[model samples]
Target: MKKAKLLAALGICGLILGACGAEDDSKYDTSTTEVSESEAVVKEPGLDELDPAVSEELSKMGTDEEIDWEKINFNKRQYKEYIESLDEQETDSSETGESTLTVVSSSMVDDNTIEIVINNTDASEMSELTNGFFAIMMDTFSRQLYLNSDYSDGTNQPTIIIKDNAGTVISEETDFIEMEETE
Candidate 1:
């Protein structure tokens, strides 16, 4: 019951943030600057190594505009309080076996990308837990960005990356990695 409610709340928050993005489209500069042929070459992220489906998904989520990272704050007082409440609710944890998650830190790789590092005691169970919560985290983070920043240009969609304690990547929630152009 609690899980269902939490998911619903997160979904609502995502919708609110999506609305927020639409309002700030004017903040982005629309001026076109001419660049030389050499300067116009854009470097892409190494995503060809991933499976075709995964690569395709990431591309759809990628935004060309850079995000203004200075204004994003997910650990503000209200959100911190909310996070604390979530911790308290975990006393009635649904899982039976040992499944613990400790968030190490979260930071921006770029404007639209938020990487959340966590230490899960059960490495074997990491995939299951990550898969379960990835959507929620993505929505929550994206919503938080809109709530905290006035610079949302609709390109503020967050791509969440989850990595385990041993520096192993557990899961990625976005399909926006840059792919090489096939000749």
Candidate 2:
């Protein structure tokens, strides 16, 4: 009976030692790993490549205007932050994901009704929050421009149109224009 108990204890010890010494499959074995030289390097598309249409539109607007492109570009970061701040207001799962923001065009229609279209797409998931964010961003952008220039000096206020990737109009606000003073 003592011999049987000793053998059982030895078996348990063997099991414990085996389990403890067992190789971990979770850890990657770099020593035996072979990397192929033919592996393709994926490159992200640059801003110019992402939206050629928008670039074309901007180019057509002409550079004769006094607008500060540097300030406008810098303001884009704030616009992004403003959108992120509104995430808590998002109750839909479809609205949460990576997104790309692009200003399609800014056109002054007869020096009164200026139209600005901003195109955005959720990189992963689609949500109402995406649209909501764009709306707020457009408002912010308009406000920034209006505060800096006489574009709102005439009877017409600017109208902004926000669109998504599928050419679907997400949001449009005509009242966003700041009325001009009658001097």
Candidate 3:
């Protein structure tokens, strides 16, 4: 029950920030700056690496925008409070040998990275939260950071990893690594 609530709260925050930060068609930047052929384009963290579908959805969730300090602080507070509440929940905690999700830590790894660690849970279990699984899971956390963090400098890599309660990484899931150009 606590695990479900934690996911729900995180999802709600994602939804709220997504809605608040989204850019509609009317807000398109009309200014054009020409770049020379020799100029190298600096890629935003994890942008080119993401699956096309995930990239599109992340853009829709809102990126390349000004910092929303008020919203960021608000969400941070909410996240902290929710995390604090997890410990207060009752736990029989007897190792019936069944794995249970005990801790969920969500935070920015840097201005360029957002990391979400699910303790005592398998990465595959995350699919249970959505109808369609891995892509949605990847999109959700990436979008959450894109919409909520101080990711203004074209730097933001999002990672989702699962670990056992013993603090060992069980899996480093998601195709967030940059791909080679096949063409």
* Residue 9 local lDDT, model 1: 100
Cα shift from native, residue 30, model 1 (Å): 37
Candidate 3 regions with alpha-carbon error over 4 angstroms: 1-100, 121-139, 152-156, 159-161, 170-183
- Clashing pairs counted in every model: 3, 3, 0
Best by lDDT: 1
Error of 1 at 172 (Å): 2.6
Clashes of 3: 0
State the weakest 10-residue window (summed lDDT) of model 3: 68-77
- The candidate that wins on TM-score is 1
CA shift at 105, candidate 1, in angstroms? 1.6
- Return the clash pairs for model 3, or none: none
Task: Give stretches of model 2 more than 4 Å off.
Answer: 1-98, 123-126, 154-156, 176-183
Across 106-165, the per-residue lDDT of candidate 2 in tens digits comes to 444443343445555545454556666756655655555443343455354455555554
Quantify all predictions' global Cα lDDT against the true fold.
Answer: 0.52, 0.50, 0.45
Two-way TM-score contest, 1 vs 2, winner: 1
RMSD of each: 21.6, 18.0, 22.4
Model 1 Cα lDDT, one tens digit per residue, 1-183: 999999999999999999988887788876767778987855433322334543343344337744444433333333333333332332212276476565666555565555656655555745555534643554454454445543245554456666755767665655433334998
